[model samples]
Target: MVLNKKGIIFSLLAIGLAGLFVLLFATGYQQRLDDQNDVIRARITSLDQGVDSFYDYAAEAQTIAGTAALDALYQEINQSGTFLTSDNFESNFTRCLNSSDGCENDLNLSVLLTNYSAIIATSLHADVQFSVNDVCLTQETFWDLVVRTNISISLTDTYAAWDTSRDITTTISTVGTYDPAYVAISASYGGAEDRRVFPTSIAPNSSRWNISTFMDFYKGRQYQASQNGSCLSDRYEGSWTSSFQGCNLESVVDADEHPRLKDPANQSITHMDWQVLTRDMHACHDPVTNPDDFRVSISDADDSLVLWNKDTIRYGLYPDHLDFSSPTYNAPGCP
Candidate 1:
């Protein structure tokens, strides 16, 4: 059969043109896909930034709120000269944090957070929500306390959404707050003019007793590391009701118990134990000439040692065992 060259040539040309059309279609489709992906990635990046910005605002609000509440509480304590119980402190802190009318010291955390959240929404043009769940105070150092605020945050943008919670904390130095013990001491013992003595008149269990406050003030002077396992040292009490004589070294705690008396961080010791340790001042020593007056006697063996003694005891006499002059002193006299 005679070959049709022109027809064959036309067939080849048509086949080539068809393949070329398919190649062009594939390249165009891939380029469009890349552009779409790029736009999505950009939107995701912007949304991520919005979430971060929201977090920053929430953290800052927590710090300011915590500090303000603490400062206000401090002022209240200063003006009243009354030691607020732990429960009272917590209640007041929450009241101050959420109060719309603001505290007497002029701080309103509720208003601060609301304004901050509004700013975030306006700037990012995104939906945002913030809720403060809790504010807690924990011991950081002997002289420092930490305030932690937990906040829940949710943010939604056109391309992304985020929901999370975090704890934002701030440290408050005791130096700034002034030693709470000193405040109690000055108020109870006739200001700085009188020797800060632990009045024997106030029963150890009395709510007005400042032993726990003094323990915190004493810092490193804890029971576990101090005495030889007993809460009171051996001493004669001639002035007692003719019945109580020698040191009644009460219940002896295990060597490992109450490793840290001032442990605000872990709180290893119970409140009851804390009370017992501070209240046993009368168990070991003779009440001074005046039953209302309790004198702290230092050991002659070691000037830093806290010994239970009668009114005739010698050196290292400061208010009880917790004194400013001695840092290494330990009082392990009561169970």
Candidate 2:
């Protein structure tokens, strides 16, 4: 009876040991699986953050590049009196964006993206590539100049077995950029072929009006006729010939050397300067005393008046024509 009881106790102890081993093995296996899942989740979160950062960086770059390009275009028009053309805009934009192209102010868009990709590659232990397919520019509103582009970004990580591509659009604003009216007036005179700049420089030019005399006759509040010492009527002096007669640079007496226009100047457009655009440059030579002989009155119904074509006007985009002189103003004896 004693030997049989000892055998039963030994058998029960062996079965208990086997159950404990199985329980320990199951717990260890579950813990290992949980640790692996946590690592994967952490990696996914890191990748998501990286992607978001990349998008933000790209957007900022595009905006800066677009702003630079737009600014350059306006400068070109301002300096050279050139008109904008849609067909040549992409090339011009690229030139402005690249520093190597001799652009006055270059953002170097390609180099910026390359450096950004390198930083991303180092952080994620992956390969990053950015490709620019096309650049499209649009003026959505008078204040908004939108830059849309086909930018493709590819990210690949071998360890995570992850690869992805994304497309993004970038925008820029010109709310307070170059004056729109200034550009319109400059372009209206002539494009690059026959560029003409207003507020003529303080130098001698037979064809264009000199700044000193222009201000004296048009903007001077104390303007007078040289012959009579009488105040000349404030009007657009569009009728003048090479003889320099009748209320012109040679005939008018300017009391103020640096004259201020009656109306406040905005974007450099003077009241008389803008009004001159409404009439033809009629050549008049009055040797005798005639106050109104060489004057082109804005109120004159006989004088041809031009109105801006609102139907074809656009903001920041190319307008083929604006209400300005066609065969631009020129003094007699000019080639």
Predicted model with the maximum TM-score = 2
Candidate 2 accuracy as TM-score: 0.50
Candidate 1, which ten residues in sequence have the lowest lDDT sum? Answer: 231-240
Model 1 error, position 158 (Å): 1.4
- Writing each residue's lDDT as its tens digit, candidate 2 over 69-124 gives 66666566556553455345556766676443645565666767788889988988
Give the CA lDDT, 0 to 100, for residue 4 in model 1. Answer: 81
* TM per prediction: 0.48, 0.50
- Residue pairs with colliding backbones in model 1 are 231-333, 231-334, 232-333
Candidate 2's error at 171, in angstroms? 3.6
Error of 1 at 184 (Å): 9.6
Q: Report lDDT (CA) for all predictions.
A: 0.45, 0.45
